[model samples]
Target: MEALTLYQLNRRIAELVTNSSTQNVWVTAELSDVAVRGGHCYMELLQKDPDTGATVAKARAAIWANVFSRLRSDFYIATGQDFATGLKVMVRASVSMHPVYGMSLVINAVNPEYTMGDLLRRRKEMLARLKAEGILDMNRSLCWNEPPLRIAIVSAEGAAGYGDFMNQLNGNQLGLRFTTRLFPAIMQGERTAQSV
Candidate 1:
């Protein structure tokens, strides 16, 4: 029988992981938690069991400051979404292990299309769920207001479309008096839902 110190055991595991994996591989996982500190993006990635909804695997990952800055902008441009919690992402990363930190993935690139497709699929699934629950169109039976006089506008401040809509409504030749109120909201990115 032989005894191994904690450091010796951890070091052996680290060496095994580093040696067994490819230098850079593409992986898909859901972002369970994400944060930025000191310009670096740190994340918790996980995979859940489809049938039971239990997390089956999890890992820590990071994008260095230099890569984060560029990747963040490129991802947003490609997907029209921020790298936020709950996002399913496909990333190119290298598996690495540190004796103290255990195992982590060092992310270098992202496949925005995968996230965009996931979002679309999720939206469709949500709509289907709502329909099955018999609430998808709960307001469809509401009476329509003919010549609707009251307008409630939810839009970003200084939006050209809002201004144009107001101009057309207020400057109508019929001179129909209408009551209108503007409810400003953030129109894009992660905070859009909360703002609305």
Candidate 2:
């Protein structure tokens, strides 16, 4: 077998990936890590086995600045929720391989309505199953304040939402002071459980 330079091998792989799959594909994955920088949103996507809860696959994904704004706005409009970690999402992405980065997905669009439906169905199913098992809302027995004053915001450092929240806090008209601080977060994957 002929030994090729690392770059040559990766370049050939990239070419193969590029040629074999050129169309946008819909994929379902859990966001393991998420970050936004210079208007671009980057994500780590993971697929876990349902029976064993073991992660079976993972990939690096990115939504460039151009596609991210429109996709995010549309998602909020359709789903009435901000895209965040711990949510399963169906995104339309194109697969690619990079010499330095290896295999990954480049997301250009997302079906927000589809994701919203998935979330709603999952919530309803969970509630029903829990109620059937007679364990639903077991936490209701705990005494807790109606509105928690201490709110900790965890997000990517340069995320737009974090910036907006800081601005809103600074511009609060009411004198009601709340102790709040943003704890930096890796919003996409398993690392978050360790950090926050």
What is the C-alpha lDDT profile of model 2 across 126-167, one tens digit per residue? Answer: 899999998887878778765455788888786666777878
Candidate 1 structure quality by residue, lDDT tens digits, 77-155:
8876667767899999988888888889999999999999998998999999999999999878678777789889998
- In model 2, residue pairs whose N, Cα or C atoms come closer than 3 Å (at least 3 residues apart or on different chains), thus clashing, are 32-188, 32-189, 33-188, 33-189, 34-188
- For residue 77, model 2's alpha carbon misses the true position, in angstroms, by 1.4
RMSD for each of the candidates: 7.0, 5.1
- Report the number of the highest-TM-score candidate: 2
Kindly state the number of residue pairs that clash in model 1: 0
Model 2 misplaced regions, further than 4 Å: 20-22, 129-196
Q: Residue 175 CA error for candidate 2 (Å)?
A: 12
